[model samples]
Target: MTALLLALASSIAYGAADFLGGFAARGAHVLRVVMVAAPVSLAVELLLWPVIGASFDGGAVAWGAASGVASAAAFALLYKTLAIGPMSVLSPVTALVSAALPVAVGLASGDSLSALAVAGIVLALVAVVVVSGGDAGGVRPSREALVLAFGAGAAIALQLICLDQAPHGSGVAPLIVGRTVSSLIVLTAAFALGAARLGATRPDTRTAAGAGALDSLANFSFLIAARHGDLSIVAVITALYPAATVLLARVLLGERIGRVQLAGLGVAAVAVSLLALG
Candidate 1:
C-alpha cells in the first residue's frame, strides 16, 4: 500500500514537471530548457542527499549515469516530437510503450503478480492511452514525429529499468550522479551545436527551475517506490502521469476534458483499487 501510494505520488510529480517543462520549451529551445533544468535538479538532489543518507557504490553510480544519458535523449526527442506533431497521437503511443517495456522486463526477471494485479496493470495501460485524448482530432503525425516519439518512449523505459539496478539503500546518490551526467551532456551539446542562445528571460529561467525541482522529486519518489514494490506495477502507475497532466490542463488552462478522458479517469481509479487489493 505504501509503495503504491509512493508510485502514484511520483506520477503526479512527473506530470506536473512535464507540464512545466512543456511550457518552458515553448518559449525557449528544448536543449536550453534541458541544460538549465538539469542543474536545478542536480542541486535539489544534492540538498536532499544528507537527509536521505547515501551509499557510494560504483555499480549504482554507473547505472544512474546510464539512466541519465537515456533520460537526456528521451526528453530531447519528446520535446522535439511534440513541437512538430499532434500530441494526441504521440502522447498515447509514448505512454503505452513506456509502460509496456517495464512490464516485459519485470516478467522476464521472474517478478510475479496476482491475477487481480495483472488485470489492474492492463487497465492502467488502457487508461493511459484513453486519457491522452488519443481519439481527439488533430493533424496526422509525420513519420519523423512518430519515430522520435518511439525513441523517446524506449529511452524512458530504459531509464526506469536502469534506475532500478541501483543497489538497495543507495538513496539519491544515483540520482545525483545521473543528474550531473545529464546536465553536462546537455550543456555541452547546447554550446557545441549553438542550438540556443544562453540568454533566457527571467520567467523562462524560473520555469525551468520549477520543472527541474519537480522532476527531481518525481525521480526520488520512483526510486523509493521501486525499492518497495514490483517494478512492473510501479512503472505502470508512474506511466499514468499523463492523467494528471491532462487534468491540470483542464483546471489551469481551461482546456476542455473530452468524454474519452473522463472515462479513462474512471477506469484508472478502478485499476488503482484492484492493484491495491492485490
Candidate 2:
C-alpha cells in the first residue's frame, strides 16, 4: 500500500489505542496500564514472526532496542500526561512535536519537500494549536509533562528516521526487537518505582490487553511505512493522528469539537490530501 494509506491506517489505530489507554489510565496507575499492555504487545509481535520473515542483525537489534526504549518512555509519559491533562490538549501537543522534530531534522539535512507539502506542514502545525481548543488558553503545561512529552517526541522522531535508515528485509525484526526491549524497559521502570504490582482485575486486564494489541498493530504498520517511504513525510503523515482522536471523541465520548477544532481538522484533511497528491 501507499505511504498515505499506511499513515491513515496507523493514525486511526493509534488514536483509538490512545483514547482507550487514556480512559483506562484514569482509574489505574499509568505504569500498571503500560505493564498490562506490554506483554500482550510482545505476544502479538511473536505471532507475526512467521509471516514477517524476520531475521535479526546485531546492528538492527541495537537500533531497535534504542527505538523500543524511546517508545517505552513515550508511552509512559503519554499515559501519565493524559491522567493529568485534557486529551484535547495533550494529544495534539505530543502529536505535533512528534511530527515537527523529524521534519525539521530532514530539512536540515537537505531533504527537499514540495511546496504543497510545505504548506501541509504549516497547516499541521496550525492544527496542533487549533486542536488544543480553549485548553491552550488555560494553565501552562506542567513542567513534568512537558519534559516527558518533549523527550518522547524526540525519541520517536529519531526512531522514525533510524528505522527508515535500517537495512531492507530487516525492518520487521528490528520492530520486534524494539517492542521486546520496550517491555523490558517498562518492567524495569515499574520495578524501580514499585509500580509493578498487578492492580487490574480481569475486566481491566482484558481492556488493557486489547489496547496493547491495537498499539502493536499500529506501530507495526507505521514501521512498514517508514520502511517504504521518506522518513520526514511518513512521520508527518502519521502524526496527523489527532484527526482520529477527534473523530473518536465525537462518537464514543460524545465530546464536542468546537468551530476552531473542526476547522483545524478540515485543514488537516486538506493537508494530508495534498501530501498524498504530492
Candidate 3:
C-alpha cells in the first residue's frame, strides 16, 4: 500500500520485537538472545524470499553487507540497553537518534522535505522525548545505559540508510543477505563469549525466536517503505514507534502512563497524520 501505512506497520512490529528482545535479554546473556534471534531472522527472510523475489548485484551485496554490520551492532547494544534500562524511556532515545540521522542524510541527498513533513518531523521528535518521559517518576538510567542506547540508535540509523541504498528491483535480496551476515556475526560473537550453547529447555529461546521473527517483518516493511517514499519522512514517521512500545508496556507490564505520555501519544498521532498528508 502507501509508504505511510507500511512505515507504521514497521514501527509497531519493531516496538513489539524490542519488548520481547529486552525481556529475553534480562534473564539470559545478551549474546545468547542475539545468537538465537539472528538465526530466526534469517529463517524468516528465507520464507519471504519466494513472495518478494530477489535479484542480487554487486551494489546490492555491498550495501546489504554494510547494513548487516550496522544491524549486528544495533541488536547487541539495543538488547543490552533495554535489559539494563527502562524500555519506555530508553527506546525513545534510540528512536529519536535513528530518525534524526536519516533525516539529515536524506535531506543532504535531496530527499525533498515539504513544510508539512518538516513540521511533522519536529513534532515526532518532541513525541519521542515526551513519550519516553512516561515513567518520569521511575529510576533514572545510568550513563553507561544512555551511551549504549545512543550507540544503538546510530547503528540502527546506519543500517536503514545502507539498506535504502540498494536497488529497487533487488527486492528482498538485500534483507536476505543482511540477515545472513548478521547471523554469522552474532554467532561468532556468541561463540567467543561462550554463550553459543543453546539447550532446547531454555525458557527464553521461544521469546528470542518471537523477537527475531517480528524484527524480520519490521525490516521488510521499512525497506519497502523507504523504497516507495522519501527516506526523511519515512524515518521520522517510523520513529513514532515509541508510542507502540510505551502503550504495550502500559498494557503488558502494568507500567504507569502519565498524563504527559498520554499527551505525547496524541501528538504522535497528529505527527503521523501530517506526514501522511504531506
Winning candidate number (TM-score): 3
- The lDDT per prediction is 0.81, 0.74, 0.87
lDDT of 1 by residue, 225-257 (tens): 999999999999988887766666557655556
TM-score of each: 0.92, 0.89, 0.95
Between prediction 1 and prediction 3, which has the larger TM-score?
3
**After superposition, candidate 3 runs with Cα above 4 Å error:** 195-203
RMSD of each: 2.2, 2.7, 2.0
lDDT of 3 at 209: 93
Over 4 Å off, model 1: 84-89, 134-141, 195-203
Per-residue lDDT of model 2, residues 68-152, tens digit only: 8777877777777765656666677778888888787767767677887778777767776677663433445677767666665
Candidate with best lDDT: 3
- Spell out the clash pairs found in candidate 1: none
